[model samples]
Target: MRQSLFVSILHDIQQVNEYFIQTRDATGAPGLSGVQKMTAAFQILQYGMPANAVDEHIRIGESTAIAALNFFTRSIVATYEVVYLRSPNEVDVARLLQEGEQRGFLGMLGSLDCMHWHWDKCPTAQAGAHTGHYHKPTIVLKAVASYDLWIWHAFFGMPGSLNDITVLDRSPLFTELTRGHAHTANYTINNNVYTIGYYLVDGINPVGQRL
Candidate 1:
């Protein structure tokens, strides 16, 4: 994370949780600061390290480190989910259309894709239903991301036994569009005007079908 961004997060988190602050006891021994706890959690999350490994460098017990990770995730969502996680509105759609036109993709809203997140701790009995073409237990995350990497839509937790087609069938990203509630984006291409927008997709995704 950027220095300024990290500082902002730290400041906001402090407001949300006093545990992040450094306090001194009567003997002047300092308790664990919030930064250390949050940093340990970040390392474990970013590097996929075991919870116990953070004890060596962070001096936090394994159970405490786990609690920190849980608290950190919840705090982040409570703090920034409204602004950073919202779907596009009318103004947002207009901006996306402008950006897409500049990039030669007229009426393009975003790029659509699905990724398989490996489930390492999947139970043996559940693995059979979760195993698909990858031959491993996984969960699907279908997303529509803009040029700026803003993920406006994400549908997760689908069983891995399904393919891209099946996943899209279950995804509600296009439900609004199908219901004619999607934002209007009229754009010109090849001297012709069109109203429906499009999203770039990989070959594995269903094509020549209504989106």
Candidate 2:
């Protein structure tokens, strides 16, 4: 990671929760500091390495490394969910529309796609239920992201056998739009004005798709 960016995250995380503070151990020696914990967590996440693979390098036990990862993820979510993971508001809608216009997609709010993440630890008995095209147990993740890389929507935990169409059938994004409470955007292109926004989706039928 870049030095400046890493330092910024360390400072922000410490600001969010004091649990990340480094202090003395039971023997009056300096214990694991927040920097060590964050390092372990980032390594595990960025490399997708086994939890134990980080123990020796980070100077932490396997269990402690895992704990640091959990704590770090939870802290980030708790501290930034409202700003980063929230549904788009009116202001956000306007900004997204402007961005779309600049990119020649006047009515586009974001792109949509579904991915399958293999579940390595899936039980044998439950494997058949989750096995899909990849011939392994997995879970589906559907996401809608804008040009700025802001994920406006995400739905996970679906059985892997389900295709993108089936996943869309169960997604709440459509239901919210149908209820008429979703954020609205208006834009003009080629002397045409459009009120409803659309998303660029991949490998899915658009029968009941949502933006």
Candidate 1 backbone overlaps, count: 1
**Candidate 2 structure quality by residue, lDDT tens digits, 12-35:** 888877768898978999989888
Candidate 1 ranges beyond 4 A from true positions: 1-8, 43-53, 178-180, 188-194, 203-211
lDDT for residue 28 in candidate 1, whole number 0-100: 98
Kindly list the per-residue Cα lDDT of model 1 for residues 1-211, writing each as its tens digit. 9878877898898888776778999999998888888898899887778899989888999998998899888888878788777789898999999988898888988888888889888899999999999999998988888887777788999989999989999988878889989888898878998888988888622321123
Clashes of each: 1, 0
Error of 1 at 211 (Å): 22
Question: In model 2, which regions exceed 4 Å deviation?
Answer: 1-4, 42-54, 62-67, 187-194, 203-211
Q: What are the lDDT figures for the candidates, one per model?
A: 0.84, 0.82
Best by TM-score: 1
